[model samples]
Target: MPPDLAIAHDFPLASCNTFGIDARARCYVRIASVAELAAALADPRLAGMPRLLLGGGSNIVLTGDFDGVVLHMAIMGREVLGEEGPDGKFTLVRAAAGENWHALVQWTLAQGLGGLENMSLIPGTVGAAPIQNIGAYGVELKDVLHSVTVYELATGRLRSMAASACRFGYRDSVFKHQDGKGLVIVDVTFALPTAWRANLGYAELAQAVAGAGLGAPGPADISEIVVAIRRRKLPDPALIGNAGSFFKNPVVSKTRCAELLAAFPALVHHAQRDGSEKLAAGWLIDQCGWKGRKLGAAGVYPKQALVLVNNGGATGAEVLALARAITDDVRQRYGVTLEPEPVFV
Candidate 1:
């Protein structure tokens, strides 16, 4: 594809991303290996432009046909980068950003590793995992992220940075910030725990997995539960185009949450670190009566209030406009801001 240029825009990304509805990349390539990807970046036509690093296409919104080249890091290789230790080798997993994330999780569980079981069934790449400090149930990628291999956009310099350099926080890291901006992630490493305790701390996950009777749940048990819950809840992108969880639940002081709760006794909320409370953005959108509401091509997901979907032929602009309306309405009613979870390009 593209004369040995790894694989070119010979394929369209309409179905590649979870947001099933979207424009195509002007020039696209699937670099089967990270070395080939590095070579592509060295090519003059592709050098020195504002580049976008994509993994599984689960967490992005393509507003329009891209003017720049899209580098699909399809490089696939998973290696134990180090020796196992007394507990379990402080195993190192070096994965190209393109590998299906859930598939990898299944692999790790099969091998008896434990750090990523809670993150099982998340719909993005290994590269983007550290970007959002991807979390589910009770575990976060930040808790296990060892390092990230990146290709800097402005200078094409490849560097491996540690977790501290990633500036991790609540659903955020340096890759999520503007400071470490313009870096294209190629590979990532995670230190999964051996003899790990399954994270049954999440209420729903606790009930379901514990009920699965998997005999004192391990990584495999938790993975099955996660996939089951996700399948039951999230609409497959293949069926309907959508980016999961359109907004982040705003973290506010408990005092503020009490004020809102006083206003609406049913205001759904969760406790967080210190005296903070995590308000559900979905609950807010649902409170505004946006659930399952239709507007031409775009509509709020019928099953999950957090997801915005493209009914059939919705353009990115229409989807974004709908999101803005929801945000404005929620803000107006609750006096709290709703932030988007997906990275926009």
Candidate 2:
């Protein structure tokens, strides 16, 4: 037999991420399929080690060597599941947990599917997308997610949950907290449309596309514009070691927003549906002069201060220290606590 299971013996995790930070998992397994995942989880060899589920490694800040088994989901598959709501021709596609999220977004747009064009260049995995309900350019994963199938770690049973059942909110979802605490996402289904109008209300996006000589654009056009804007602004994680965004935008009550706005007339905030307002964490960090500031390998990105970079070789602790300092500084200045977007394990 395969000695119960076959896995890489103590693999280095630094190269598996865009962050390029060095760390190691006591044990590591590359799950090529969900069947493989089941086998790995049941392997008696890894009984007591903590389990970690990782995808594209685009949004996490691995702060230390994991004293556990790490399962790298690489299962691959994609299919048009079906059509949906009022538009019989609109489609839904199922994506494997390992599928690159941004590539899938590009695929959908190329197929003339319109729901996810705004989220063009975001990096991560399809499975992880639903966890955070990934959003950009005014569109979020929850907006198009039809359902997600997960493998419960406790019982090894496959359970599928719908969007409403997923409890999706602004960058928050049930998969991220409850119901999915120990359940590992295996695949996700997205509801898409054959044709749709794009939301260009975001000033930067509007400016980018308008400047690109297209007032009203097609699905691909919008994707191109979004990518272009992102390219010009956000530093590529491949070149610079950093998770896409390091902090969650803080949502403050309208009264609090008013208070801050009065103090800083140019305060940037987006009004939420719940009467709260979401403040840009990047803007806040930039205002604090944290942008492009590094201390012994860890630093804030120059253009996108909300993103922290691992410049060459940052120990997990150093990056964490930088992040904690920024959070404290921002809190002391604005009286609003900032939360890190990455899950620290």
Candidate 3:
């Protein structure tokens, strides 16, 4: 072990993860710097042990105790790297992986940066954002991402990767794949537009802004509205044990979408730029009568059918069972397989 590295044994992880599953890590370490991370990884005592790189724990479901090492990223910092792009049209800002994601959004807004306003109040750390390509309202991380600094575990060296190299997609990135298994994000950089425009691409957001009587809404206005909307729709992980939305909105071919529309006239869907259609997973779960329904201690959130909650003392197995049941029901009824958003551990 490195001189500065402190490893704890049998660490309780109920509070680490948003789902609050009572799982334990055989060994755990809080990594506050890249040097410390590299040193710990190089230590021979921990060699060949499976590792879990944990961030805000907002996007994972622990099924049982992990019999390996848990690297809890705690690196922190944020700064303005000044302007970039053609004729200096964008402001480049960077943040460490351990920083709270929502806090970073607020900080950027405080600095008069506007591009991140549409994604306000998302949970998780900055490092986890790129891995999941976190998005909300009408904005995604990829839209403003400049690049990411990562510590390659295999070589014990640092590398800066461009957004394109990350291969971002709807709720996905390279970090989720086998090729990215050895990479650990240390920080992220974003290019915020100098001339900002409010993104009201989502109807609910546009209606809320209009209803608020803001004839000309600013970035702050959009951010406040998005925060309010999320507060009203999503359950706070502190009060309720949940990992936000449980499933991704299934995308289907235009022909398939048309067929489903003909069979179910009231089906909720949004057209994708790729000529496919994205169906609302929440609406599907609700239509299947899973909202507010429970199996053991696991249940669907009453306000949002997309969220699955641990009502009280719910085991991870119970949550998995509930998810499977919901998926099976939705598939049986609509012929669409619902893919879960959270990583199952």
Candidate 4:
């Protein structure tokens, strides 16, 4: 190891993950810069060890003690990089990997940017945003992402990948795949529109805007409304340990959705551009009677059926057990297999 590099052994990770599972990492290091990350990865002592690149830890579930190194990304910075495009119709902004995702949204709004408003209050760091292609209300990270700068672990080379290269999907990106294993995100750049318009596409958000009586709402207004809605629907990780929405809204073909809808009239679903229907995972779990229910120390959040919470001193095993029960019930009742949103380590 380099003389300047600091590494801790047997580090407790309960506080690092939102699920609050009392797991420990065999080795841990806080990486603050690209150079530091390179050095740490190149260190012979750390060679051949399994690596976990952790960001805000909001989108993960630690199943047990990690047997390898945990590289906690702490790189931080954010700034407006000025306007771009031939017509200068877009304003570009950049934030380092470890910058709090919600803080970045607010910062952009403060600078009069509007594209990120609908995703307000989404937890996790900027780097994790791309990995999950985090979305909320009516907006997704892919909509505003311009490019991402990453350090390739295998080659020890830095490269800038455009949005097209990220291969974003619903609640997914390239970073979640095998090809993305050693590519550590350093920073992300977004291209916000100069001619901005409020995206009130989501029915609930649109209704909220109407209820708020805003005839002409700006980015901040939409953001405030989104934050309010999330506060009411989701539990705060600080107050109640949770990894936000626990399941991805299952997508079904239009025919399948119609069949299910006919069988169950009260089904909550949204139509996708590709003609599929996105069924609400929360509603499915609620229908399965898991809401506010507990198994051991893990429970489904009372306010949001989609959220699985650590009631108190919950083990990762307990959380997984509760999640499995809920998944099984939903699958049995609805004939749809619900997939967990958080990465399990």
lDDT of each: 0.80, 0.84, 0.94, 0.92
Best by lDDT: 3
Q: Lowest-lDDT window of 10 residues in candidate 3?
A: 1-10
Task: Encode model 3's per-residue lDDT on 1-345: one tens digit a residue.
Answer: 355678899999999999999999999999999988987898777788899999999999999999999999999999999998798999999999999999999999999889999989888999999999999988899999999999988798899999999999999999999999889999999999998989999999999999999999988899999999999999999999999999999999999999999999999999999999999999999999999999999999999999999998888999999999999999999999999999999
How many clashes in each candidate? 3, 0, 0, 0
What's the true lDDT of residue 38 in model 1?
A: 67
Choose the strongest candidate by TM-score: 3
Cand. 4 Cα-lDDT: 0.92
TM-score of each: 0.92, 0.95, 0.98, 0.98
Please estimate how well model 3 matches the true structure, expressed as its whole-model Cα lDDT: 0.94
What tens digits encode model 2's per-residue C-alpha lDDT throughout 1-345?
Answer: 332456776689987777777989899998988778888877888887788888988767787888899899898888876777785746889999999988888877666678788898888888789888888887888878888998888888998988898888878987677666987889998878656777887888888888889866888889888898788878788888887888889999999999999998889999888899999999999998899899789888888888888888888888889988999999999898998877776
Model 1 off-target regions past 4 Å?
1-11, 47-50, 82-89, 213-215
Of 2 and 4, the candidate ranking higher by TM-score:
4
Q: What are the runs in model 4 whose C-alpha is more than 4 Å off?
A: 1-3
Candidate 2 lDDT for residue 183: 75
Q: How far does residue 334 in candidate 4 sit from its true spot (Å)? A: 1.1
Which regions of candidate 2 fall more than 4 Å away from where they truly are?
A: 1-4, 87-89
What's the TM for model 4?
0.98
Give each prediction's root-mean-square deviation over alpha carbons: 2.6, 1.7, 1.0, 1.2
Q: What ordering of candidates by TM-score runs from best to worst?
A: 3, 4, 2, 1
